[model samples]
Target chain A: MSMPKGSNIGQFVVIEEGVKLGENVTIGHHTVILKDTVIGDNVTIGCNCVVGVRKSRNQNMRISNSSLDPLVIQANCKIGNHVSIYSGTTIAQDVFIADHASIRENVEVGPGTIIGRGAIIELNTKIGHDCTIQTLAYVTGDTTIEDHVFIGPCVSMSNDKYMGAREYTLKGPYIQEGAKIGNNATLLPGITIGSSAVVGAGSVVTKDVADFKTVVGSPAKDIRYLVSKEVSEHDTTT
Target chain B: MSMPKGSNIGQFVVIEEGVKLGENVTIGHHTVILKDTVIGDNVTIGCNCVVGVRKSRNQNMRISNSSLDPLVIQANCKIGNHVSIYSGTTIAQDVFIADHASIRENVEVGPGTIIGRGAIIELNTKIGHDCTIQTLAYVTGDTTIEDHVFIGPCVSMSNDKYMGAREYTLKGPYIQEGAKIGNNATLLPGITIGSSAVVGAGSVVTKDVADFKTVVGSPAKDIRYLVSKEVSEHDTTT
Candidate 1:
C-alpha cells in the first residue's frame, strides 16, 4: 500500500496491497479498498464504503462477467457514506456520488455526474458527464447515457424485455445528450431517447423519441417539439 | 453487552454497551450495533449493517424528531448486508430485509414482511404484516400501510405535495389491506389507496382509488374492478 503526501485515512480502514492513494486523499472509517485500486488526488470517501469490490454472480444470471479490470477513481470526487463501488469501474473527476449509492462492475461514470442517494448503477453501463441520476433510480446494465442528461427520482430502465423468463440478448436504452427523464418513468429495453427530449413524470417510454420532442403518458406519445435547447429546471431538482 | 447462549459473532463486530442479543443469534463481520438495541433469538444479520442508528436532522427541516424509542428486532428475522435500521424502529418476526435497504427512525415493520434490496423505508411509516416492498421502492415518510400489501420495484410515494417549496403538513399515502402497487408507479401525497386495489405499472396516481379497483395511466384513471382477491402473480415477480 502506498499513500502519497497529505493523505488522511481514518481508523479501521482496510487498504489492501497494491493500492495507491494520491495526494490529499481523505478516507473515513471502516472503508475497504481492494487490491490494485488507484485513487487520484483530492478524493474524499465517507464511512463504510467498499471500493474496488469483487463481483459475485448468481447462478441464474446469464451475463458473462468472468474477467474484470481494476478500479480507478480520478481526482476531486466526493463519495458519500455506505457506498459500494465495484472493481472494473472508472469514475471520472469532480463527480459527486451521494450516500448509499451502488455502482456495479464494468461501469464508466464520466466527470461531474451527481448520482443521488440510493441510486443503483448496474454493471456494463456507461454514463456521460454532467448528469444527474436522482434518488432510487435504477440504471440497468448495458445502458448508454450521454452528457448533460437528467434522470429524476425512481426512474427505471430495463435492459431485458423478457424479464429473465427466457434466453434473450440484453440491450438497454440509449439516451442521447441533454435528455430529461422525469420522476417514476420507465424506459423499456432497446429504445433510443433522442437528444434534448423531455419525458414527462410517470411516463412509460416504449419506443424511440425524436430530438427535442416532449413525450408524456404511458406508451409515451409526443406532446410537442421543444423550441429551446435547455432542459427543464424542474427536472434537476426532482 | 449481554449475548445469550449459542450466539455467533464475527470479527470486527461492534456490539455496544447495553445491547442485548438472544440465543442462536448470528452477527456478521464489521456490523455495528448501537447502544440498547434488542435482538431476539434465532435472528441473523449480515455484514456491515448499522442497527439502532441515531438520527440527525437537517438544518432546514421542519419536522420534529427530537424524541425516539429504542430499536427492537423480534426473533427469526433475516437482515442482509449493508442494511441501516435506525433508532425507534421495531421489526417483527420472520421479516426478511434484503441487502442495501435503509429503514428510518420511528418506523414499524410487521411480521413476515419482505423488504427488497435497495429499498428505502422513510421515517414514521407503519408497514403491516405479510407485506412485500420490492427492490428500489421508495416508501415515503408518514405513511400507513396495512396487511398483505405488495409494492413493486421503483415505486415512489410522496409525502409533501408542494415538494418542500412551501409550508405544509407531510402525509404519505394510506395504503389499505391487500393493495398491489405495480412497478414504477407514483402515488401522490395523502391519497388513500383502498383495500385490494391494483395500481398498474407506470401509473401516476393522483386521487383516491376505490377498493378492488384497477387503475392505470398518468393521472391514473380507473380501468376496472378486480374480480378476485388474489394479487396478480406477475406483480410479485416484478
Candidate 2:
C-alpha cells in the first residue's frame, strides 16, 4: 500500500495491501479500505465505511460469478458515514454519497452526482453525470440513468416483473436525460422514461413515456405534452 | 461499564461508561454502545452499529427538547450490522432489526417484531408486538402501529400534510392491529387504518379504511369487505 504525502487518516482505519491513495485523501475513524482499491486525489470518506466490499452470492439466485475488478473512487468525491461501496464499482469525480447509502458491485456512478441519505443503489447500474437520486430511493439492478435526471425521495424501481415467481431476464428502467420522477413513484420493469419527461408523485408507471411529456396516476397516462424544449428544460432539469 | 459473564465483545468495540450488559451477550466488531444503555440476556448485536445515539434537533423545525431516558434492549434481541438506534428507545424481547435499519429517539418497539433491512423508523413512533415492518419502509414520526401489523417494502407514510409549505399539526397514521400495507403504498397524513384492513401494492391511501376492508389503487377505495373476522385474520395477521 502507498499512502499519499498529504493524506489524513483517522484512528482505527484499516488500509489493506495493494490499496492506493492519491494526494490529500481524508478518511475518518473505523473505515476499512480493501485490497487493490484505488482512490484519487482529495477524496473524503466518513466513519465506519467499508469500501471495496465483495458481493455475496445467494443460493436461490442464479446470477453469473465472473472475476470482478477492483473498486475505483475518483477525485474530490465525498462519501458520508456508514456508506458501503462494493468492489468492481467506479465512482467518478465530485460525487456526493450521503450517509447510510449503499452501492453494490459492478456499478458506475458518474461525476457530480448526489446519492441521498439511506438510498440503495443495486448491482450493475450506471448513472450519468450531475444526477440527483434523493433519500431512500431504490434504484434496482441493471438500470441506466442519464445526465441531470432528478429522482425524488422513496422512488422504487424494479428489474424483475415476475419477482422470482418464474425464470425471467432482469432488465431495469432506462431513464433518459433530464427526466424527473417524483416522490414515492413506482416504475415497473424494463420501462423507458424519455428525455425531459415528468412523472407525478405516487404514480405507478406501467408503460414507456414520450419525450417532453408529463404523466400522472397509476398506469401513468400522459397528462400533457411539454409545449417547448425550453419549457421542459425549465420545469425538469433545472 | 459492566460487562456480564460470558459476554463476547469483538475487537475495536467501544462500551461507554454506565452501560450495562447482561448474560451471554455478543457484540460484533467496531460497535459502539453509549452511556446508560441497558442490554439484557442473550442479545446479539452486529458490526458497526451505533446504539444509544442522541437525537439532533434542526433549527428549522420547532420540536420540543426534553431530556431523554436511556436506551433499553431487552433479552434475546438480534440487531444487525450498520444499524443506528437512538437514545430514549426501548426494544422488547426477541426483536429482529435487520442490517442498515435506523431507529430514532423515543420509539417503542414491542416483542417479537421484525424491522427489515434499510427500514427507517422516525422518532416518537409506537409499534406493538409481533409486527413486521418490511425493507425500505418509511414510518414517519408520531405514528402508532398496533400488534401483528405488516408494512411492506418502500411503503411511505407522511405526518405533515402541508409538507413544509405551511404550519400544521404533525400527526402520522394510526394503523390498528393486523393491518397489512403492501409494497410501494403511500399513506397520507392523519389517516386511521382499521384492524385487519389491507392496502394493496402501489396504492395511495387518502381516507380512513374500514375494518376488514381491502383497498387498492390510487386514492384507494374499498375493493371488498372481508367476509368475516376469520377470513381477514387468515389472510393478513397469520
Using Cα atoms, each model's DockQ against the true complex is 0.19, 0.19
User: Reference contacts recovered by each candidate, as fractions?
Assistant: 0.27, 0.23
Query: Considering only N, C-alpha and C atoms within 3 Å, which residue pairs clash in candidate 1?
Result: none
lDDT (Cα, tens digit) per residue for candidate 2, span B39-59 = 999998877889998777788
Write the residue-wise lDDT of candidate 2 on A1-238 in tens digits: 5667788999988787789899999999998787788999999999988787654321232342421788899999999999878778999999999998988788899999999998988788999999999998989888999999999998988776643335888898999999999998988779999999999998888789998889987758877542454587788876
Clashing pairs in 2: none
Q: Give TM-scores of the second chain, every candidate.
A: 0.91, 0.91
